[model samples]
Target chain A: MENQAQRSPKRRISKDHWTAIAFLIPSFILILVFVYGFIGWTGYVSLSNYNSLVPDFSFAGLKNYIYLFNDFRFQADLRNTVFFTILFIGLVIVLGMGLAILIDQKLKGESIFRNILLFPMALSFIVTGVVWQWLLNPSTGFNQFLSVFGIQPKWYTDTTILAGFEWGSIEFGLPVAIIAVVIAAVWQMTGFSLAMYLAGLRGIPEELREAARMDGASEFQVYLKVVLPMLMPITMSVVIIMAHISLKIFDLIYAMTGSGANFVTDVPGVYMFETTFRGNYYANGAAIAIIMLLLVAIFIVPYLWSSRKGDK
Target chain B: MAAFPIGKLIKYIILIFFAIIFIMPIYVILVTSLKPLDEVSLATMWTLPSAIDFSSYVEAFSKLAPNFMNSIYLVVPATLLSALLGAMNGYVLSKWKFKGANTIFTIILFGMFIPYQSILIPLIQFLRTIDLYNTIPGLVLVHVVYGLPITTLMFRNFYASIPDSMIESAKIDGASFLGIFRHIIIPLSITGFVVVAIWQFTNIWNEFLFAVTITTSDQQPVMVALQNLSGSQIVQWNVQMAGALLAALPTLLVYIFAGKYFVRGLLAGSVKG
Candidate 1:
């Protein structure tokens, strides 16, 4: 009887553990089918000759990828994505870290300034796109203000490449029109980095800074040397987060400026959407998506792996 | 030396300058939306409206109301289901601590960073096969499934702060799995629920790529409809501005009210899980 009593509790505990795992099973299966399984399916579609209205699962090898590389629009997309990612990530970090440090100074009306900067994060990228489209309209909006200083730049409508050089079917230098889209994107996303850096800043101990000050470090040096290094992890998180968003950016560019005149603002997201849905070039679209996924995975895989390892 | 803090003055000046530039869009949106269409030309872009008008808002609201309702229907259910599932998964992952839990979690977290375009082709095929394409429920399922990673990440981190000893004591008291979850985890993680819900609500509400591709007219969400507002041949800048505000209103309101929770969600979603 006593033996039965002890084993009963153990059996019951095991039963409860089974239930715990059972609850997780449904989500696990859904993610497998939806996330992982669908990715495999996409890979298959990318490899097939599925380029028409009807499904064509016949093998085409790397023809779609080769076509994209040689194509003018897709080449432009690759260039635009590279420049946009670099400029957007760079500006967001500088601007975000700057605002974070300024706010950490604990000035009067700190919350108000923080709220104003962060409110844009709440608004949709579509709204940001639409509103900025007007605000930066070549002939109107900010141009009206800037005209007082005798300058009016055609923002998104400008088709000029800033430092032009031919590398492939298109210019491989910065596209001036992309700057307009970048401005709106930076405005919307800087708040995320700011919040992250601010959180990181707050988590840091005051004693560390006090110790630096006692050692005769200037405020700027203290932040540059002591604080900035400490915020490196947060910076990594921000870069990865922003890099992924920048890589797949569509709505903002779509609504703000559709592929510019020379496909200057086009990225893979826009290309994939247009070619697949509008043009019905399914295989090509799948290829673009796979490329985008690969680009994002380059940053994400390492980050996720390291973080997971760190957790253990 | 200057008696005044010149450093403080420079700081305020710099902050205010950026603040003005940052809020310029809002100012333009407000000013333009209140003006008559004739008064909304490029020449008068920076000027405040000669008179406040609600006509654009009336037009925008009429066009957007149905779609706004679609967003609400999509967001509420998706947020709830995802948050609930996240809480359940989080409970098991954090307190249960079975083998391979971290690996499973890392696999799931990868989903959060993936470009949705990668999965678009097959996802559409699967949805169409199930006859859920072009429906709000389909969008709901998409949001919930995709939302799982972040929501799970958030809830797991939230629950991690909760000590394991509590669960041990409850186990000692002979509470079963469901009983412990029902009586213990739920009540303790109410704030976690709020954070996760707010995050999911904002994301699903503001999401464009899915809303645009998945559903068509009449079933479209407000963001898609607002995007369509500018597609009309004769672009009414006033109406466009008003529609932008209307579409953004729900999330802006959430940020305004529950901003603390919203920021907490932001931190939780991004920082190491």
Candidate 2:
């Protein structure tokens, strides 16, 4: 009976279907023109090397791709993206779920906790970036404050060798940028994830919790085996959404690092822009855009299908 | 019904810890903004202001010349249009099943994840081609298209949750498409519209990437102007933090009013990613 309730009522499905279709045209046009249309146009442009202002692009036939392989920053961008993805997706989900679980319990000032957690979600990353830059800058930020306590938090420090590898590689390294991006994004989004987990937690029947408590299951045990598994759908949704955001991150990196970022902090979206419009490599930018879009699709469509299938 | 005092204590501790982490940087920014330049030390960026000062807030508003007003101008109209159109689109897509309906919805949902930067160049090019790129009209068009998927999705899901028999009854009474939406559906769904408004308002108000890229002038939006003026002076920390706070205040004020739905709606409706 509960499961039956979530479904759209079957009566007048046909009429509702028609209305849905009618109302859908504008969005359909947006997707058709902007989503696919951009890709199609970009594909055409990539083939012709139109660098700036629609320069007469002669067909280059995969030259851009070949050039990209050799392009140092391109390779660095891909690697940085993967690293950023792994960290952002990982932390946002773990910390998000962690924070979510911690807050799920009915507590005093729970709403206050929720508000503080969610406040960052309402901030523009451009603003957040400025805040973080100030927070991280060695000369002006809390890093400088650390000096008063006899601990220096240097924004740009030389690497120290460790075991077989070098530590704190400043040039061509993104330790500071990575920390800044992850901290800011997680602070902003983990609350979102927490909210999601809370939703799932709310959906868990009181009887279930009662049953677990009745069985002498410890609080941690009940959560580990019961709440955790039950929260899978929420977890999946959180991961997928975080992954999508990680892939498309631009404002924070763009604002913090600016144009002179030691070739570090370049993600696909940034590279895509750098290639597409900034570099005037429209097709390559489009190609980059396509890849980023596909990455997004890979995360979203499957999850949708999986959830839908789960429903069925 | 449960009285686990220890668990309650633990929960409070954890919540307090995260609350501190969440509010710390914002607190630091506030303190920094409120302190005068002379009171600032080379160190102790985390310390409280020596004296309570309001000049930063004043300068941020007055120095920038309607600094706060410009953001409201752009955000209010944009939010209304985006949410309105989004609701309309969601209604059509969810209620009407025609050819390519699912496809259309899916693609539009896909737009949810498209980074504003990936298309920034081409979009700028496209916008410039029409001379609407830098104008508010141009930004409005972009925001509408971008805002559609989420807002529409919200309306769609909410509309879907409503019993279909009620809709059929409205239709059987000779209600037309607009008639049902205006009289029957929209009347029942103020919450969904409010959720969309909150989401849209926050998003557009806090938006930076497109605001930075599309609008070329300091006269555009608070976000653009704030960033443009950030380091214009060697270290105008007071002004910058104040500007940042001013940039944050409107949305924060909005959030304070309806922060509950900010969490709730995010969990229920899909974020565009």
Candidate 3:
């Protein structure tokens, strides 16, 4: 590297380039050391059983992974994570697509709508999780409030007292966590999807809409038949990002339940945190992380690639 | 025209409905925050406060004082310095077109999706080894690494869009790289650069996971502290709500002030590239 720098003396150097390099080097080194270096070290640690409060290391290869496989909590957490991602991705797309369609209507006060829609997104995770947790806490939140209105609805603890759906059981666990977090997330995310979708809507040629109208299509028919298909690219954009978010969802669970080891609601990220930091099993935490990485890759890489191809 | 009016009205209705539902949670939070502590306890949380009270704001400010300052102590300098340096990287890579530039960009893009948790295990140890663990700089470095990719990518896209002829013209006239950048590029790219800066500022300000894990104190970021307050259930709800508001206020203010930058800047990468 030094030799290349020395050899490049005749290459008409500029302070801008030097400054740029200088500015970037710190961040580059930070990422390289903290991210890549740590990942490589995690790979190493996964091979050993590193316990907490002990400045010791051992070399036990693949046994940690094997134990990780046999661990029921790990398996259950895997299922819970998959469940969260599926439900979250599904709802965000449906509701987000709906919001995008509705908001895309060059209506009144669009910016106000946009800002209100986007504002919740600015709340930190602690705020997001705590707010949602308080609302859905059943005894002290929305349900209790509703009870005073002569409508005692049991929303969060299952039994879908929402007047339409009957889930048949009152389970206050992962299902509630998923539903609660998704509502909070959707409250925060629909704006993002709406923004992207509005951009997509704006991108569509006005001629297409007029042409649909000229074809004797009603406005509803035009929106349904002509506009929906055009929104796929933007819809995919929202899905890919939200899918990644849904996968490593730790903050919501941690803020809600404080990482309880007893009940369910435990996603892989939380499990990894507890397994490593709280439980003193660093190797096992690495194993959980490896699994999380694999799961995210399986979901996101394809979406980004296909979208890139979709444009082509 | 008659049929069009009906359809348009329906669209407005649906949009308003969805918007209301979307903002309902935040509205709930606002009302929750304004209620008196006793009123918040005895009364239902969904309704408006019987009377406005400011004591909870005082309590929350005090409870959140340590972490609130901790967040400022970390996010401000971290965002500014990172953006400054990140722009340099973006500018140099875009303008200089040095060797391995493509590889560097590719690596940065790859870094975007790599799960941060995977790096935490070794990071804790590495931080300990280097004595950077549990410190503001360590946490800021973590944020810088995360912040650099998107910000640099943004600045690069924006800088790349600036015509090469202007830069070359400056170069031919004996304008050094810095001179060209200072005179031509930076000024031209200021809007986009500020856009990226705002994005990085909001992001670093809102971050919780890294701050919580990397820094081991109640003096973590505001988000981490808000989360710790989550456990003290007997803790005053008004104060809790107030803390939540205080923690989120700066980012909200930033978003409001930099409205265009946040919207346009957030979408800049996708929009420009």
lDDT of every predicted structure (CA atoms): 0.92, 0.71, 0.72
Residue by residue across A127-234, what tens digits does model 1's lDDT show?
Answer: 998999998898898898888999999888888887889888898888988999999999999999999999999988999999999999999999988999999999
Candidate 3 lDDT score at position A144: 69
Please write out the lDDT profile of model 3 over residues B1-273, one tens digit for every residue.
445587778777877787777677678778878887777763477788889888888888888888888888888888887677667777877777766666666566546667778888877777788898888888887777777777777887788789876776676699876777778877897787688878877878887778877887654878888887767866777677788888889988988887777877667644426
Chain B fold agreement for model 2, TM-score: 0.90
TM-score of candidate 3 versus the correct structure, residues matched by position: 0.88
For residues A144-231, write the lDDT of model 2, one tens digit per residue. Answer: 6566788765542312211222323322334445555667667777777877777778789989988998999997898898988998
- Residue A98: error of model 1 in Å? 0.6
TM-scores, in order shown? 0.97, 0.88, 0.88
lDDT of 2 by residue, B115-212 (tens): 66545555676888999877777887788878877787787777777777776677668888888888977888788878888888888887877776
- Candidate 3 residue lDDT tens string, A203-250: 888899899999999978988888888887667667777877878777
Query: Which one wins by TM-score: 2 or 3?
Result: 2
lDDT of 1: 0.92
Give the winner by lDDT: 1 or 3.
Answer: 1
Question: Which regions of candidate 3 deviate over 4 angstroms?
Answer: A1-27, A144-176, A258-262, A300-312, B1-4, B98-100, B269-272
**Model 1: which residue pairs collide?**
none
What order do candidates take by TM-score, descending?
Answer: 1, 2, 3
Error of 1 at B68 (Å): 0.9
Give the true-contact fraction for every prediction, in order: 0.81, 0.56, 0.60
CAPRI-style class, candidate 2: medium
